[model samples]
Target chain A: MSGASTSTAVIDPYAPFSQGKTIQLSSASPFLPRYLASTLPPHTSPSHVYNTRLRGKLLILDNPLRESRSAQLKQERAAKREAEKQRRVQGVMGRREAKRLGVWELRKEDAKWALFLPIHHLWLGYIAELLQLPPPPSDDILHSTDPSKHRLPSVPGTQAKLVKADLHGSILSVKRAKNADLVGRGGIVVHETENTFKVVTAKDELKVLPKRNSVFTLRVPVYAVRPGTGEEDGGPMWEFELYGNQVCFRSSERASRKFKFKETIEL
Target chain B: MFIDLNVPFPEPIVYESQFTPSKKKQKQKPAGLTNAHASTSAMAVVPAHPLERLRVPDRKALRERVEMLIHLGYTIIAFTQSVQSKLDPAAPVNWFDGGEGTVFRDLDPRFNGGKRGVVQLRRLNVVLDEASEKGFGFNAQTTQLLAGYDILSLTPLTTSTFQSACLQHSLPSSSTIHLITAPLLPSPRLPYYMKHTLVRTALKNGARFEICYAGVFGDGARNWWANAREVVRAAAGGRRDGHEGVIFSGGAGRVEHLRAPGDVMNLGTTLGLPHETCHAAISRIPKSLIIRAETRRTYRAILSEPKLVFSAVPAGAAEDGGEQREDGKGVKGLMEILNEEEERSRKRVLEADDAGEGQEGDGEESEPSGRKRRKRRRKNR
Candidate 1:
């Protein structure tokens, strides 16, 4: 072994084994000379070498100040984050004001606008209401939740058997089975035929026909129904909805609940 | 000027049989500071970062992208589970193939091998819990493992823990959550504890949530969307009055519609749906959609379809705070179903007895004949 290699053998990789404890100590300077001894070898007197190093001498770096690479990176990130925060706050304000001035176009803003545009729309609408901006001429269809009430003539029908019930809707008005009564009623409806029906009550059934003479409730289209399990009795159970004239349907996957519902309604 | 009308149209190139595998595309880091919290190991291995921001889908591009993922270390099963769980946890977490195997032989196919192997599950669970405890916005909840699911919890880990794990040759924090469950929406019919645990780990660590919904138009047209933007937009638009600033779904922004964040015990009353129906809806919607209910705001919705409107009572119409439904609708427990079945059988027996009584013509004589016939049939068997 080289003369230097011979000395390195004395040092321990896992060091500071005291009593029953094993503490890992840095071995970086195990062979490196103390600052006092550059032309000479490091003697057993570490204290003597330390004192000698205090005096002007040919130096050996026993423990150099190592760079904290991660610390520097953290500082840089903090600076960047501060800058970003300022930018986002400014953007929010700018967008809000511009919306107020009625000159804001979604296309002109940066991609961040896409993130904030929906929020901005809501805020601006609120602000406009507070400022008493002349209400943009409102239409019944635009605001009314009961557009069906204005058109549909009440149908004379009884609620069908309740298939399923939730906190929101009940699955009722099921056809194709034997005669059944409205098991119970909070909301009830009757289907006279496949195409003629009324929402006398809010049963979670399909409103087969037009609510009014001309206006029709939306039902999901037939083609949208996913091919069912093909049970011998009935191929599959399908659900439909009519958004005006459009219909939507979904296939059932009872096991995994991966039902595929398709919307036939155009936005 | 005469136009040449008979010019032969160029034949479309038919490249179906000749599959030209494209060059591996570069993996993309999610939007924002992907490095802020990601472990170096995750960054190194999973080049395409999944957690930082929204991933809008390119349907045409999915096949190739998935193929590339297969080329990477991920198993097809992992990929499918990741995608489906992201869409809806209730959806059975399925895969294209059982696992990923190299096209060539002589390769170690398992995730871990002899020497310098990855960390084990027990250690992983410890690390994740420690990290979550140390970090802000990180919380861990331990509960009974749902049947057919893994037993673990999803919790956010600290950045420092992430760094150390990478340096220590342990599994990435992204896969730390062992048993996860998606938030509820649509329907809460299906629950997979093991798949959910994986999803929770991925999400808590940093996986972006995406919903892949196949839809069609009113004209019988079909299309699929890989993101939740369109659904959110439409659902939000349909909200009556003004929205309560937030919407909740199953998980985090993964399904149709949105809901408020936080506990939504009274979502039905807030949304103007019957309480039972609302509860049912919340339970059913998979962990795909993020859900929250307004603290003080209530929105009234007009129920147009009668069948769509559910009654609060289990049996007939009952007042608020009444007994369960009479028809046994929405009864969900082992005991309840067993009781229902017992009741049904007893009803059948009673009906048979009634039929026997109605046949009064020599009923006493008929009973003896029936016994004789049964004995004869048994003997023949």
Candidate 2:
């Protein structure tokens, strides 16, 4: 009687059974066993079995469960609030980093560089500072001395030397040029490159003069230190008249170049 | 010395327009306008004055005109030749040999006698109506003009044209720019063109505003008068602000149109220019312009303040060497005086220290206070 009851309970009522054929079919149908295993609760305790069965019914869509619209909106709002909180944390971190790095002070220095240097030179000077190299000459060097005392050297030998000297902060006057309009104009040298000088004239106007086909007389001041006292003594300034085409390179580049000391060539 | 900075020379060739109608339109027979027609015809029939006649004078006539100008005491006369454009090849070719050489040649023989007056050949480029289509190109035209002319005067028709001509040039600082004020007579007020900022820039760039007096003697006298008054007001305003760049000229096209320097000065005074400024316009300014033109012609000349430094003279030459030595001495004397003054001050300070010490020692010493102290100090020294 017990055997008969066990067989009846183990067998599916809806499935067809035919002795040997049914056994073969049951062995071949592995998916049915896998599905039955998935549906069965692992635990036999009353509370666990009840919960597992409820989850199985929900997974199978036997119960048509839906979330409320207000609850969905509240979830979306919470996600946005979390994202905003993360952004605020990031902003606070950024401000703290900027403050620690003295970014505002750096910006103030950049502003001063923008006022004085050309765009390319500004970057060069900035990079130079980063590399801990010597900074390029500044306007303060020019303003420290009396400009009126600065005169150009008239001697030919001295003139050649003066032409090779760094022209930054020198007072320049156009002596002669093919352009008649440029004759006899004077200006202060603000910047210089390989082929041009950026000058600020007496009228407070900036002018760029090409170093080709123009003659310039540079008035450079000479400052000396007293040998004994080591005090600065204002020396007599010298004047130099130069053919612009001959000295059309940066002072540093020209210094590295080798030239015949006494080559008798007409400029 | 009086100078007429602008007198149009190589008299203008009048070409009658081929497009004029073959016959005048018959007076419209206005049905009831007979009275108005009669008055209009009467106005047109009035006899033309001798000065009003516009005739192209020959070279002889120009010489006679110069003689008349000399008689009227114009010590310096800048004969202005109008240059049209480079596309007009004739104008540039005419400038090369015909303009400067011919005028000077024509006037030289007549003025060879005791008169030490000068005749300057100047160029006037009237850039009217065409500046809008093509910007004032610093091309072959400008280069040729700058190369050929002694003094270049640009008469831009509009304010923008003026700015482009004056401010946009590469070398505005050294350029001798003259602003012609005659054309403004039939148009707007002078201040419309001569804005304060523009005037300041012009002054800074060494540009001089010129007033041509011959415009006043033209057929449009009323318009000219109004223009002249406005120009004077603008110039006077500039002067009051301590920037004086006004120059007077008689841009006479013919002998009859010419006015005396005295008359121009009186006109300047009447137009509200200060007396000294009126004199400077004719004398000092023109002289400086002549020097500038002379320097422009000679490429080798080096202009030093108050004098020109010539490179042609040998460094060791004794002819003008004394002047340089004298200048050196003068500078050295000034320096010596300064040094002496400094030494004297130092000596005074040392004497003050000695006096202070002597006064302190007097209380402790047993010698006569003042008289013996000097002898004692001398002995101690």
How does the DockQ of candidate 1 come out? 0.02
Cα displacement (Å) at residue A113, model 1:
65
Give the alpha carbon lDDT tens digit for every residue of A1-267 in model 2.
655455444545577655574333453453344445544443334445444563335245476668899999999999988987898888744567777987533242233322332432332233223323322233354234444433322333333344345555445666545564555554546667788877655454566777776766643323232224322123333333455655677868865754332111112
Local accuracy of candidate 1 as per-residue lDDT tens digits, A15-117: 6535875434455543334422443345556557655654345466698877699998999999988887898878744566677876523232232323432
lDDT of 1 by residue, B1-381 (tens): 000001111111111111222111112223243333333333233222221111224222333333332333221111111221011112221111112211111121222221221111110112233423343221222111111111122312333433332222122221222222222222222121223333333333322222211121122112222112232222222334312211222221122221222123253244343343333333322111110000001011011122221222221113111123323343222212223334465679999989878877668888889899988965873
Q: What TM-score would each prediction reach against the true structure?
A: 0.16, 0.41
Query: Which candidate has the top score in TM-score?
Result: 2
Off by over 4 Å in 2: A1-267, B11-57, B84-91, B96-102, B106-117, B130-133, B137-142, B170-176, B188-192, B238-243, B293-315, B321-381
Q: Score residue B297 of candidate 1 by CA lDDT.
A: 10
Error of 2 at A106 (Å): 53
Number of backbone collisions per candidate: 75, 6
Model 1 interface CAPRI class: incorrect
